[model samples]
Target: VAGQAAANQVFNSAFWVTSFLPAVTATLIAKEKAQGNEDGVQDAVCQAIFVGVFIALVTTALCFAKPNQILSSVLSQDAPAMEYARPYLLVRTFAFVPSLISLVGFSAFRGVL
Candidate 1:
C-alpha cells in the first residue's frame, strides 16, 4: 500500500495542478461562445485534453522509466517496502493516462455544461 500511496501522491499533485485546465477550458469556451465561434470552443476543449494527456504521458514515462527513483524519493531506499512499492508502481503506471483522462472528461463536462 505504501507504493500505491506514493503513486497516488504523484497523481494527486498532478490532479491538483491540472485541475485548473477545466476552468480555463470553460472560460475559453464561454468566451468563444460570446464571440460566436464554435470552433474556438472545440479548440479549447481539445487543448485542455491535450495538456492533460501530455502530462499523463510524461508522468507515465517517468514512472515506467524510474520507479525506483520515485519510490526511493518518497520512501527510504533501505525500507522493506521498497521492494513491493517498485513493482506496484510499475504496474500502476498503466492506469495513469486513463485516470487523468477521466478526470479531464469530468471536468470538461462540467465546463461544457
Candidate 2:
C-alpha cells in the first residue's frame, strides 16, 4: 500500500511536468508558422527538443541526488512510502525526455496539418 501510494505520487508529479509539453510545443510551432518563417518553425522544434531533454536530465539528476528530500516534501511522513517512492521516481525520470519529445512532435504535426 505504501509503495503503491508512493509510486502514484511520483508518477503524478512527473505527469504534471510532461502535460504542458504539448501546449507549449503547439504554441511555438503555431506562432512560427503564422509568421511564415520556415526556419523559425525548425528552430522552435529544435529548441523544444533540446529544452525537454535538458529538463529531463536535470530532473533525473535532482531526483537521484535528493530523492528523500523531494519525496518527503511531496509525500507524507511515512518512511516506508518514501523509501519505496525513491527508486520508482528515479526510474520514471528517465522517461521524461522521450515523453516530452514525442509530445512536441505531435504538437508540431498538428500545427503543420
Candidate 3:
C-alpha cells in the first residue's frame, strides 16, 4: 500500500514494530524471571514511539488520504483491486492511531518487568 518513495519508511517501520513485540515480550519475561529492572517504562515507550510515529504520520497518512482516483494512476486498470484497495487502505490508515496506542502499550508492558 505504500508508494515507491515511502518504501523504506514502511519497511523500516514494519521491521521495528514487528521485531519489537517479540523482543520486548521475551526480554520482559526473562527480566521478570530473573528479577531484573522494573523502572524502564519511559525508555521503552520512547523507543517504541520513536519507531512508530514516523511511519504512522507519513506513510499511513498518505495511504489514507490518497484519492480513489490515484489508484487508477498508480495501479493497472484493475477495477476489482482498486475497489477493494480504497476502503481497505482508508480503514488501515484510520485504525493506525488506536493500533499504535495498543502496540506502544504492549511495548510499555515489557518495560514494567
TM-score of each candidate?
Answer: 0.82, 0.80, 0.53
For model 1, the superposed segments whose C-alpha errors exceed 4 Å read: none
State in Å the error of residue 61, model 3. Answer: 2.0
Q: Model 1, 53-106: lDDT tens per residue?
A: 898899889888887777776788887777777777777778877877787677
Q: Report the candidate with higher TM-score, 2 versus 3.
A: 2
Q: Of the candidates shown, which would achieve the greatest lDDT relative to the real structure? A: 2
Error of 1 at 83 (Å): 1.1
Candidate 1 CA-lDDT value: 0.75
Residue 103 of candidate 1: its Cα lDDT? Answer: 72
Q: Candidate 2's residue-wise lDDT over 69-110, tens digit each?
A: 777766766676776777777777677777777777898887
What order do candidates take by TM-score, descending? 1, 2, 3
Range of the 10 consecutive residues with the lowest summed lDDT in candidate 1: 6-15
Q: What's the candidate order when arranged by decreasing lDDT? A: 2, 1, 3
Checking candidate 2 for backbone clashes, the offending pairs are none
